[model samples]
Target: MFCTLLWGSAAPFIKWGYDLFSISQTGDILVFAGVRFLLAGLLVILAGSLLQGKLLTAGKAVMTPVLTLAFFQTFGQYFLYYLGVSQASGVDSAVITGTGAFISLLMAVYVFRYEKMTANKALGCLTGFAGILVMNASALTQAGGSLMGEGLILTSQVFSAISAAFIKKFTRTHDAVLLSGWQFACGGLALMLSGLAMGGSMPGASAAGWAVVLYLAFVSAAAYTLWGLLLKEYPLSRVGIFNCIIPVAGVFWSAALLHETGQAFAPSTLAAMALVAIGVWLVNRPETPDKRSENQTCGS
Candidate 1:
């Protein structure tokens, strides 16, 4: 939960970092995305080696899936997120990213069949999305950014959902830390190569810019590793419920950092948040015997 809160705070900080560095000056969006991921990946690898003694070695059989997971989660998802943040406000970006839980639930039900959508879950999903709408309503008036960029952020959420499902598939056999390190390494390498291809260069970066990069590398990457470990140990349904706290934390952080003023909180936002919180609690609480039996029968 603490890691998630920290990760949530990263959006505004990353936006500030991009502003300080002007990452676009190097070349293109891909370059900017690549550099951040590459640096982060290297740090994770180093951390894994120092903390765990050695990295996990996968057989040729599992290498492809791991790479694919990395590509979706680290490369595709974050590349789009960075581009979106560059185009939009941190608050906007954070809320959109928070929508990933809803997308993940949909994917889990329809595609993976790992979970069913009960009434409570449906209510929770709707309430959570309503909260996002309430938050973004004010920003809707001033439309300076490209819709494409916003769409990209939403698309990244889908990729994240897919990656979550994929990661769950292999967690039983893999060491989460080693798996996370490899994913970061591969994803970071992919980003760096893309950056080089686009003629990206990191010159004249301010101390603040470097600080942001370090935070992203060490804290974000390390926290993500811990998250992977948690996911492996817990049920996805239960683990995912904690993600709801992220946006609430993000909104408060944005208000503090951006010095946002006079934004009236609508009753709907509170109501939506309340409903979602209740839904998460209900969904994750220990199921009654009848519910468990039903689930087992359904599986059979």
Candidate 2:
């Protein structure tokens, strides 16, 4: 719940963060994303050390997953996502980003073999996707950003889903807190290096800009750590379904913060949220006892 809230708030704040820091180029967005994650990774480690009475630690053997996570999850995901976020409106970012959960679910089924693909999930994805399209239909023609902008944001979710699968697979023996800390740290450093190499510089932001950065750092620290823990205790679909609420909260926060009054509470936005919720429900809906019995009977 809190995890979803943290994520939901990100769309608005990210747009505002760009404005606050005057991010204008891809290099700048990368640098900014790098800074935010680097700070977040450090904070997560610090919090873990304090709460657990020791420095956050990881095993040498788990280094493979850590590196993979850093490359794919934090670094690859954020770099592209920032490009998308910068191009699209905040509301669009929020709505489109919600589709990541379904992407994760799909990956879980095919890549991880942790779940199976069913008709229900297929339909759910279509419904959710339709909602995403409705939210962005007008923008496709209005010339805010390329179709690539929305595409990149949606693609970022695939990496996010992969990250979750990594956590679920690895955290069987290791601590989620440890993995979260290391991946963020490694990924952040890598992203920062990439940004610097690409000729990106930190913008001269005001005090307010620093505040936004810090808050984003905190959000990642708390949410990623908690999300890691939650993944350990629940199946991916169960936990992932909760992520659907993010867009709703994101839209609200964007409206309130950015003062997008006319579009915030618009009919289309509400309808999109509703469709997504229903789609998520269909995705996460457990098989009924009768259905189980019927399957068993057929097998027999």
Candidate 3:
């Protein structure tokens, strides 16, 4: 819940960051994102080291996992997401982003075989997805999004799903904090270089812009580290299902911070929130003894 809320708050803050930094170009967006994640990584490493009374280390054995996560989680996901959001309608982006939980669940169930694909899980995802659509139904009625926009957003969710699986796998052996820090650092560096190569610049950013960066960095560091630990100890379905609340949180925060309060109080918004809550409950609800026994019998 805390992690999802932090992540959700990022939507409005990011918008503020772009406006404050006067960033509109793709390369500039990448550069800004790179700086944010780079700082986030350093913050995590410093704080984590202090907590454990030693520097967090990522040896050669963990380097592969770190790099793999960097590519899919940070670089691939955000790289495409920023570009996609710029091209897509806000409604379209919101709907596509909602698919993340579903995609992550699919990867956990099928790609990694980390969990069984149960009926409740499928229904939960469908219900949560419906909530997202309901919240955006007003704008969704208009049809005008490009393939580059919608397609890239969908692809970014796929990358996000892949990263979730890898995080669960790697955290079994490596320090979750170490993995989170190094992967963000490596991914940020890649984005920085790519942005530079593409002629991105942030020469005129003010103090306020930098402060927003700091906040954004903290959001990523704290949320990702905590979320990694959760994944370390719990099933992917259990942790991933909570992500359904992110969009709902986004709406509330956007209302509070951005003064988009009208929609936040609308009937559709309330209905959407209720649906999301129900979906989350369904997904995280404990399995019945009958179902467990049935599964055991089937396996036998």
Candidate 4:
């Protein structure tokens, strides 16, 4: 829940950062994101090492997973997301990206075979998605979602889901925080290079702009490190369902911080929150003994 809230603040903060830094071009956005993640990676490594009482070095054993995550999680996901958001409506982007948890569930159950596809998981995902729809009901009625825009956003979600599954798998053998930090470092570098290659440059930087970058970096560092630990110990569904809370938190922070409070406390927003909370509960609810027994039998 805390991690999701941190992530939710990101959209509004990124917008603010762009304005403060005078960022308008796609290349500049990529460079900004790259810098944030690079700083975040360093913070995680430094803090995680201090906490663990040793240096968090990436050995050859961990390099494969680190690079894999760097590609899917950091560089690929954010690259597509920035591009997609530029072309898509904010409502469309939110609604589409909200499917990330649902995608993670499906991939975990089928592709990874890490868990069974239970009725509870399926229903919970659907319910959460419906809440997202209701929450964005006003803007959704405006009919502006294009193929390129929505398509790229959905693709970015796929990368995110894949990264989650791989994190769960990798953490079984490697240190979760170590993997996260190094992967972030690698991916951030990649994004920086890509942005620079595309003629991106940050011409102006203020103390406030730098502060925003630092805060955003901390958000990613802390949230992802803790989230990696959670995935290490729990089923993907158990942790992933909380993703629905992100958009809700984003709306709240956007309202309070960005002063887009028109519908912050509206009935629709409150109702949507209720639906999302219920969906999270349903997903994390313990399975009945009978259901577990049936699953075991089916496995045989």
Candidate maximizing TM-score: 2
Which of 1 and 3 is ahead in lDDT? 3
Give per-residue lDDT, candidate 3, residue 97. Answer: 67
Question: What are the C-alpha RMSDs, in order, of all predicted structures?
Answer: 2.9, 2.7, 2.8, 2.8
lDDT of 4 by residue, 125-169 (tens): 788778766766665566763467567877998999999999999
lDDT of each: 0.70, 0.84, 0.81, 0.82
Q: How well is each residue in 1-300 modelled by candidate 3, as lDDT tens digits?
A: 999888777766776777788888888888988998899999999999999999988788999999999999899998988777666544345445666887888898788888777778788888887876776676556686337766787799899889998999999989999999999999988887788889997765999999999999999899999999998888787788777767677777767666767766778877877887787787777779987666445323
Model 1: per-residue lDDT, tens digit, 155-211? 888898888877777777876776777787788778767767778766548887787
Q: What RMSD does model 3 have? A: 2.8
Prediction 3 global C-alpha lDDT: 0.81
lDDT of 2 at 32: 86
Predicted structure with the largest lDDT when compared to the true one: 2
Q: Name the candidate, 1 or 3, with the larger TM-score value.
A: 3
List where candidate 4 sits over 4 angstroms from the true fold: 85-97, 135-151, 263-272, 293-300
Per-model TM-score versus the true fold: 0.86, 0.93, 0.89, 0.88
Worst 10 residues of 2 by lDDT: 291-300
